[model samples]
Target chain A: MAATNLSERRLARFWSKYGFVLAVLVPILLWFSIFSFGPILYALYASLTNTHSLDPSRARFVGLDNYISLLDDRRFLASMSNVFRFVLVKGILNIVLSLGLALLLERLRRGRNFYLFFIFMPVVISQVAVAMLFLWLYDPRLGLINYLLSLVEIPPQSFIRSTAQAIYSVAIADVWKTYGYAAVIFLAGLLDIPQDYYEAAKVDGATRLQTLWRVTLPLLKNPLVLVMVLIVIDGVQHFTMVQVMTGGGPADSTLMPSILVYNYGLGANNYRMGYACAISFIMFVVIMAITVFQLRLFRSLYD
Target chain B: MTDISLDRRAGGSLPSGGAGADARIRLREQVIALVTHLLLVIFAFIAFGAMMWMVLASFKSASEIIAKPPTFLPEAPTLESYALILREQAFGRFFLNSIFVALPSVLLILFSSSIAGFVFAKFDFPAKEVIFTIILSTLMVPPAVTLLPLFRLVSRLGWADTYQALIIPVCVSAFGIFLLRQFMEGLPSELLDAGRIDGASNWWIYRHIVLPLSVSALSALAIFSFLANWDSYLWPLVIIYEEKMRTLPLGLAYLLGWSSRPRYDLFLTGAVITVVPVVVFYSFFQSRFVRGVTLTGLKY
Candidate 1:
């Protein structure tokens, strides 16, 4: 009987301790149930339907039709191509420029703080504001860039006007806005390096370039991976700048997948909700795959 | 700072100081460093120059803005564009709309995340590790994936164009909870134990012991949340159809009014107005921003 009483007391204490935690778990579970899981499930159902935003009552089930049609959509193909171009050109340029700036900032003797602040200023500004700023900068006639080009005897070219150049111009604007963030991250990594590595290299009669290549680059793996992963994730989700600056204009040359999804869901006259859901799902899978691969890559690199 | 100076001396610069040949090497190093400074300064100038040019253009006449050589500084600065933005457009309403959306969202995020963070940090429960890992893993999923479904859900709830549409969906941030949990995990357990010994409930301990201790982390998270909500454009653009309900960015976009003749000065003015508040807020919390970003890196 005494043992039985002791067991009851223990059970009571356990319940008392965890009751609040169980309460907290309810909200979390509900959140995932409603917001996270609910959305994906709804999207899945929508993807299998021929639902239109304008006429929700006439919805009918259609298996994979949206996905199959999306494959043939020229605009979707163009958006995919545009994303590739953006990821390659802007991604590579941003990394190189930011890394160079990081190295240069690391070498500075004075006024480093001021330079850091100034460089990162653009990043703190809203993307919408950045877009507007670039709109002015990309102005054909009165813009500073054009004025400078004229000074060097280069004729003013209309940026953000030509179908071929609009995406690249947008990419340039994005690179300008985000490169400072990458540079700062790289600088943090550079600061973490021990002086001993460089010292040993110098003792071995290594030149500055050799020391940098041998000591700095290898040690910077973690932050490099982190920055690269962040850039890729952000690059994949590029929407607002494209939406505001060009509106995916000049024959849809600047259209990214995100903007395409938004257009299909809301902007277009037809409002194909099912098609948009499929696109968003594909985007989700792509990002998840990239993220998983990156995590594995980072773990291996670190190990 | 001292370590850097010591490293500079120990890296053979002292020996170089003793010889004429070393003097030339030192001079060359200085030259290189100077050149680096010049390049950095040029980049800095470009950033500042762009901002200044926008502000100047906002005050210039439209003809002057588009004229040959492009007025570097407005020949005669005027508030005409500002007046036009305030009087003819719904700029004031947009500003208020942004504040209404951003402030409540920030407050809710802070309150909910802090409460959740405290529980995760201080409590011992079954499947804790798994739960935390799941939360962290959600960070990898890009927000774009949820947009369509979220839109559908919001529409279903009839929350379109309302603050509830904006605030409710974003109130529970995994990142904020994760950040606060990391911070709270570093706090001493004894303080909480003492609070418990005094017959304080979990909520009481959270209020008296945890909240005060985690002020820095909370403030940092607050700044980030505010900036994020303030800058949010696409989501608002999707939901808000009316001009008066639009945020600053959307308002600025529409101020140009889908017209062939874009009003350059008013657009610049609206852009400036949208950017300044954020700039001011960031400047005030600059150190916190650095500390926050750096801390996240370390935690990772």
Candidate 2:
């Protein structure tokens, strides 16, 4: 009887201490259940189905029709190419610009805060607003960019209207809006470098260029890798700017994978939900593979 | 540039009798400083100039905006566009919707994430490592992966056009919990022990000791949460169908899509209206914002 009482007391104490944590866990579990885990399961099921989002009751188990069809779709192929271009070109540009700005800002002794504040302003602004702003800025007739170009006797070029230039133009706008964030992260890494290293380099007659290449670049590897991975992920998942600015227009030149998913799943054609789900899954796998590979590569670099 | 050169020249003259070598070094240093400042200033001007242009264009008459050379400042600046946006477009309604949706979502994220963070930071429970790892692993998953599945779930629950659909699914943030947990773990354990010795309960310790000490982290999390929800586009775009239920970003997108021929002033005015609250909020919480990003970088 005494042993039973002791066990009961122990159980009561555990419940009393942990009851709140259990309560907290319930909502999180439900969130994962309904949103994260539930969707993933549903997406898997949908990927195997012939169901459209508009008419869910009509869904039929078609066994990989969507996946096989995706391989043959030309637009999907184009979007895939677009993603690669964006990931490589825009991603690299954003990193370089951000790192360059961070270095310049670090060298300054005065007005650092002012410059930091100005640079960071774009990051906090709504992407939709930035999109709209860039739309006006990219206006072929009255836009600032074209107007500036015309000052040096250059002819007006229809930036968003041209098939060749639309993707690059959209990428430029995105870089302007987002590279500030990369700069912020890089600045933090720059600050983390001990002043002693710079002093040591200077004492050894290292020039600014040499010190940057040997000391700063080597120490900045982790942040650079982090920013690169983030930019790639962000570039792949980008939607608002493409959606608002060009609507993947001028012969589908700027159609990103996310934009394709949105158009199929939610746009005017009504629910190609299953196809959308398949695309999302593919995107998920691609992003996961890239992230894992990059992380491993970075880990090896550190080692 | 001239001032820098002068300073360099004076320093060079005092340093050595070999004036030629010193002077050349000084000249090179001054030239580099001049070029660096010029480049930075030019970029700064471009950035600030673009923002200023947006503000000015929002006040210009439609024709003035499209005029040759595009008027630098509006000839007759008017509140007509602002008035039209607020009255005809009902941006006021959309603004209120954004506030109502974002504020509650931010509060929920902060409260729930803080509790979860406390557990992860202070406790040694069963499967702690596994649970923490699961939470961290979710960070690797792209948000797009959840879009279709979430839509299906929300539709099934008949929450497609409701605030619950907008707020509930996003209220529990893994990143928030992770950030706060990292911060909380850095706090000394002696304080919690002292509180226990004084017969204070865990809840009491959390309220009195932990919460106060974690104010900086909490504030940082708050700013991030607010900005994120305020600027959220895609999920809200997918979920909320009604005009009355739309957030700011979606509302702006709708306005852009509403007119066949886009009105520069009206669209820009809407953009400005959407941007102001966030800029104000950020400026007020600037220190926390910097601290948050910096801390995350250091840890990651």
Candidate 3:
């Protein structure tokens, strides 16, 4: 009876602790379960169905047809190609430009904050606004790029209006808007390296370029991977700029996967809900795969 | 701050009181530094030049803006673009919509994530590790993948175009909880011990002790949450259907319009409207913002 009584008291104490844990965890869990996890699960299910309308309950299961159909979809194919191009070009520019700018900023004695403010300003602005801003900058006749080109004695080029140049133009605008963020992140990483390392390198009579290659780059491995991963994930989700500035224009040149999904699932004349989900999942798998590959590639290189 | 000094010393820019060889090396280093300085200055101007161009264009007449060589400066600067957008277009409505969606979403994430962080940091409960890991693992689930079902889920809840649709789905961030927990881990547990020993309720301890101590993290997360929600595009674009309900980004996108005609000046003005305030706000808390990005790197 005494042992039974002790066990009962233990149970009560367990309940009290569980109560506190539940109070905090339940809301977030409920939120995640309902909004995040549930929806993703729902998306998986919907991908197998022909759910065109908003009411997903009415969706009829069509097996793997939606997935199969996406394989042959021309626009979807175009979007994937666009995504690969974007990831490649944007990825290279981010690392090179940001690292270069960060090194330069690190070397500067004054006006670091001012430089940061201007560079990082685009990041704070909504993508919609940036897209709109660039639309003007990419204007065929009067845009900033062409105007600058003319001043250099080069003929004005129809940037976004031309089919061949449209996607690259869009990508360039995006690179400009986002590279500042990479620079800032790299700068932070640079700042955290112990100053003593530099002094030691100085004592050894190392050149700035040599020391940077041997010391700074090596020290920056983690931050570099982090920056690369972050940029990849963010870049792969490219939609707004394509949508607003070009709208996958000049013959579907800039139609990214996200834009493709939005177009199919939500565009006025197109509402292939089932197919959209399938495409989204395809893109999801692609993003995850690239992320894993990037991390492993960096690990092999540095570690 | 150390970056500057370390770089100077590393380059041997300041002579170490030496002979002919050292002086030549210093001169070479000085020349390199000068070149680097010139390059950075040019880059800075070009970087900030985008904003300068936008602001200048916003002040120019439509004809003046698209002139052959283009007006570098507005010869007769006017506020007509601003007036046109605000009065004729629905710029003001879209601006308010963004605030409405962003503010609530930011606040909700802060309150829930902070409290959750506190609990995760302090409490020893059943399944704590497993549960925390589950939450952390889901952080990588891209929003793009969930777009379809989320839209349907919002539709089912009868909140398709409402601000609630925007607020509810994004209100809880796994990343935010994880970040705050990392912060709370550094707090001396004894800091809350006094409150606990005094027979105060857990809520009271969390509110009076944990919340106050976690202000720095909270503020950092606040900026992140706010900026993130403000800059968000696809979700708002998909969820919202009504014209007046459009957020700033959506409005700016539509200003490009489905039509062939381009209105550069007004579009630039609208862009400025959406961008200026957030940039100004960020300027005030620049250090916090930098620290926030750095903390994100450590998440790896």
Candidate 4:
């Protein structure tokens, strides 16, 4: 009786020590399991089978068929190439503009926040809203851009209407919306660098350009890597702005893989969930590969 | 502050330089400053001007919105577009639905993340590192990978067109948990220990001590998560079939298909309605939003 009572008392102590932790963590982990982990595992399984979006129970195993077909699939190829161009255009413009803005902001003696407030305003709004604004701005007939171009005697351009300019036009609008975010990140990274470094560079009589190249850029490697990877990942998975602006239109010129996934998985009479999942997995692998490549590249460049 | 010293250092002349050279250098610095401010003002104007144009366009008449040589200011500014959208599009319902989904989701994320962060920060438990790593790894998986499966799951649960469909899947953010954990770990443990010594329960100590001290991090997370939920589109588009069940973004997008041709007037008005509230909120907590960006590097 004495031993049993002692063991019960120890159990009570253990419960008292860990009850709250278990109560909090159990639900959260369960949530992750149900929502996060479960869906990922399900996608992996569904990608290998012929599944319908509405009727998963009828799915039949089809080994590598979807993956093999995607290799030659014209639309899939277009999406892959389109996303490649999208990431490239977005990464270059976003970096240059944001870095320039960051440098400019870093030099300001006053009204820094005021400038940032206006610049960062776009980052906070909805992608669809931005798309709507740009749609009007890019309107062939009534757009302000065309009107301004007419003032300069430049002919009106079909921004999203033409196949060639559609992707770049969408890219430009996205850049306008997102560059400020990278600017803020770069600005934060800039401010974190010690002023003593600049003073040291000055003592050596390094020109402004030399100081920026040898000192500032090297010190900013982390944020640069961060911003680049984010741009790549975001650009690769981009859907909302493109979907809202064009719905991958003007002869599939801007058909992103995410849009393809939606078209295949859920379009009326096109419930090819398995095919869509295959595309999603490809996108996943591409994002992972590019991200790792970027990290490795940046590491080698600076290290 | 640092700029002041930098300016002084730049303005200070070489010991061998004459007064003319000093004047020249001062002129050069002033020219650089002028050019810098000029370029910055243009950049700022471009950024702010587009949104301002969108706002002004919303009030113009339908024909004037798309009129030739587009009017910079609405010649006859009116509330007709707003009245049309509110009455015909049921935007008010969409607004309420957005609030209904976002408020609960943000609150739940905060509660779950902070409490879990508190546990991870203050407690020693088995498999803690393993669990945290697992959660963090999920951040790398893009939402597209899970889109189909989640749709399947939610539909299976008979939750399509339900508010829970919007709220539940996103309620506990991995990023939020990670952010709050990083924050709560910085909080002084002595305060928590003092509460413990006073025989307070872990819950009480978290409620009174950890929660209060974590206001900054919590608020940042709240703003970000709230914005994310408010701006979410694809999920709501897929799940919500009912007009009344739409979120703001969804309702705004539907305005495009509502008319045969592009209605710039209604589109701008809907956009104005969609964007103004967040911009207003952002105006108030502008620093927190910026800090949240640096803190989490989240792009909305």
Candidate 5:
């Protein structure tokens, strides 16, 4: 009886020490399992099977069929190419404009906050709202852009309607809304840079151009990498604004993989869950590869 | 510039040869400053002007909105479009739905993240590093990879048209947990030890000490998550079937296909309604919003 009492007390002591930790962690881990982790594993499994979204019980193991078929898929190839152009245009414009704005903001002694307030306003608003605003702005006949162009005797161009200009036009809209965010990141990095570096550069007879190239750009690497990776991830996974603007139209000129995922999985007469999952997995792989490549490149360049 | 005049005075007291070079350099600096401000003004104008123009257009009549060489200001400045959207498109309902969904989700995330963060910060346990790494790794997985399975899972649970469908999937943010963990780790452990010496339970110490101190980090998480939840589109578009269940962004997107042709009047007004509140919230907490970005390196 005394031995039994001692064992019971030991068990109670263990629970007292660990009870709170388990209480908090168990529920959180369970949530991640259900919501975050579960979906990932399920998607991976479903990618290998021909599972219909509406009726998953009828799923059959296709064993890499979905992955193999996407190789020659015209729509899939177009989406890959389209997203590449989107990221390119977005990255260049975003970096140039944001870095320039940051440099300018860094120069100001007063009114920095005032300028930043307005510039960063666009970053907080809804993507759909931005998309709506741009749709009207890009409207062919009655839009502001075409009207301004007409003042110079330039004929009205169909921005989203034409296949040639659609992707770039959409990309420009994305850049306009997002570049402010990159500007903020760059500004923080700029502010973190010691003023002594600029003084030293001046002392060495470095011109403004030399100072910018040799001192400023090299010091600004971390924020630059951060902003670039963000742009790629955002550009690849872009759906809402593009989906609202064009729905991947004008003969699929602006088709994105995310849209294809949605279209193939749920759109009318297309319940190819397995195919959509495969596309999603490919997108995942591409993002991971690019991000890893960027980190390595930046590390090598700076380190 | 004022600084140049001050420099001129200082240069006036210096040697004659140095004064000329000083004046010339100051003049060049003045020119650069002028050009910088000019470019910055243009940048600010372009950024702020587009949104301002949209606000003005919302007050325009349907006919005036489509007019050639759009008027810089509304000719009549009527409230008809706002009335039409709120009355006809059920945007009032969408606004309420956005609040109802966002408030609960944001609050839940704050609670979950802070408590979970507290555990990670203050407690010692087995597999902690492994668990935290796993959670952090989820940050790298694109939402596209999880979209189809989540959709199937939610639908299978028969949560297709419910508020729970939107709120629950997003209740616990991995970013929030990670952010709060970093913040909470900086908190003093002595206070907790003092409480524990006084025979306080973990929950009591968390409630009285950790939470009160974590208001700043919690506020940052609150704003970003609220903005994110308010702005979410794809998941709602996938799940919500009922008009009454639509969030503001989803409702605003539907305005595009609401009619045969684009209704700029209603679209602009709906957008204004959707954007104004968030803008107002952001303006009040501008520094926190910026700090949140720096801390997390993310924008919603």
Candidate 6:
């Protein structure tokens, strides 16, 4: 009887300890199953059928039709190419400028935080507000940018007005808005390089520029890749700036897939939910591919 | 840039006659330093010029804001636009809606993720690794992919256009869970073991031991989650159509068209209201903000 009682007490203590862990873990897993996992599965199903969002049960399957039509869509094609163009040009500029700024900032031992505070100031604010301010700046008649151009005796160029200029204009605004993030990340990376590397470079009497080119940039591969991946993500997901500034055009010139997906999926009176899901899935593939590729490259290079 | 620095460090090592070359290099470095300062000043101007321009423009009359050559300062400063925005534009309602959505969203995210992260980090359970991997992989699915179906589910639950619609779907993030989990793994296991040894329950361990020790990470995630929800545009834009349900960013965007006129003063004013508080808060706690963002990039 005594042995049986002791065994029962040991079993009860075992349950109490491990059981508590399950209690915490179980709810979260269930929540994810319902919210996150369930929705993705539902999205896969929605993409295969013409599902009205309000009445998803009334959907009928029409596989591959949405994807096929998407291939034929002019606006979608334009938006894809536009995003690629924007990402390529803007991505390069952002990386170069942010790296330059990071190097310059690393050189400064004083007033470093002050400059970072302002450079990062724009990014911390809402993108909508930034777009609004740029609206003032890009205005033809009374804008500050045009006024400055006039002072230089250059003709006032219409920004965010013509189709050709619109995408570049929005891209520049976005680069300016977000370059600080890349700069700071680069700064963090620059800071992490051991002093021995610099000292050894100094012993070799390597010029600062050469040392930077050889030592700093080479070691900076991971952060650079990280910055590139982030910029790619931001570029692919570009929406609010485009929406607030151009609304995808003077003529769909600045259209991004993000805004496109949004308009089709959830815009007023246009509930082509199935088609939108297809578009979203395609973009998801592209994003995941880029992220995985870059990350693998970075990991191989760094580790 | 390189010459002057070396000279300073190795000045004593140089012979006395090399002083002339050193001075020349010094002058060169001075010129370079001066140029750097000038460029930085210009950068400062470029960085903050537009924002400051908006603030000054906010105080100006509509005509003055658009005046030729543009007024540098308000000829006559007024709160007229602020008053109108608050009274007519329903700015108060939108601000409250943002707070309503953001506060609960952060609270729920913090609550669930911290508890979940603690267990995932400390516990040895069945299929824990596989389940954790599944949750983390879900981070790759962009919100766009989930938006339509999530909307269907939300509307089905009778949450459309309500604050719950905004809060519930977004209250959970794989990224938050992942971030907290990484932080939790770094925590010392001894404190938790001690708590357990003292007959403290798992809830007690998380609440009393883990939560206090992980305060910094939690604060970072707190500010992060709040700002993300506050700045969220897409999902809220889709779900909330009612004027009363709109958040600050959406309200400001709506004013771009919905205003009787473009109303530069009013537009700038609304933009200022939407952007300034968060920016100002961040400026004061700038270190915390940077740490949070950097953690996102540097950590998993």
Interface RMSD of each: 3.9, 6.5, 3.5, 4.0, 6.2, 5.3
On a 0 to 1 DockQ scale, where is model 1?
A: 0.48
Could you tell which candidate, 2 or 4, scores higher by lDDT?
Answer: 4
Off by over 4 Å in 6: A1-14, A296-303, B1-21, B259-261, B298-300
Per-residue C-alpha lDDT of model 4 across residues A102-219, encoded as one tens digit per residue:
8988778778888899999998998889999999999999899999999999999999999999999999999999999999888887777777788888899999999999999999
In model 4, the number of clashes is 0
Q: Give candidate 2's error at residue A177 in angstroms.
A: 0.7
Model 6: per-residue Cα lDDT over A143-244, one tens digit each: 889999999999988899888888889989998888888887788777767667787887899998999889998899878987898888778877888898
Estimate the lDDT of model 3.
Answer: 0.81
lDDT of candidates 1 onward, in order:
0.80, 0.80, 0.81, 0.89, 0.90, 0.81
Give the C-alpha miss distance for residue A130 in model 3, angstroms: 1.3
Residue pairs with backbone atoms closer than 3 Å in model 2 (clashes):
A53-A271
Model 4: colliding residue pairs: none
Q: Per the 3 Å backbone cut-off, how many clashing residue pairs does candidate 5 have?
A: 0
Which window of ten consecutive residues has the lowest lDDT sum in model 3 chain A?
A52-61
Candidate 4 interface RMSD to the true structure: 4.0
- Point out where model 4 deviates above 4 Å: A1-3, B1-21, B298-300
User: A1-303, model 2: which lDDT tens digit per residue?
Assistant: 999999999989988877666766767767767666677778788889977776688888988899899999888888888878877778878888889888877666566667767777787888899998988888898788899889998998888878888888888888888777788778777766777777788789999799999999889888888887787777777788888888888898888888888888877865788887788878878887887788888778765
Q: Is candidate 1 or candidate 4 better by TM-score?
A: 4
A-chain TM-score in candidate 6? Answer: 0.91
List, in the given order, the native-contact fraction of each candidate.
0.52, 0.54, 0.65, 0.65, 0.71, 0.60
Chain A TM-scores of each predicted structure, in the order given, are 0.91, 0.93, 0.92, 0.97, 0.98, 0.91
Q: Best candidate per lDDT, number?
A: 5
- For model 5, the superposed segments whose C-alpha errors exceed 4 Å read B1-21
Candidate 3's C-alpha runs over 4 A off are: A1-11, A55-58, A196-208, B1-22, B298-300
lDDT of 1 by residue, B1-300 (tens): 101210122332223334556677788877987899889989888777788888888888778877888778789888888888899887888899889989998998888788888889999988988988877766665566677778777888898888888888888788888888888988999999999889988888888889999888888778778877888888888777777788998888776564587667777889999988988877776666655555554221
* Distance from true location, Cα of B263 in model 2, Å: 1.2
The TM-scores, one per candidate, come to 0.92, 0.93, 0.93, 0.96, 0.96, 0.92
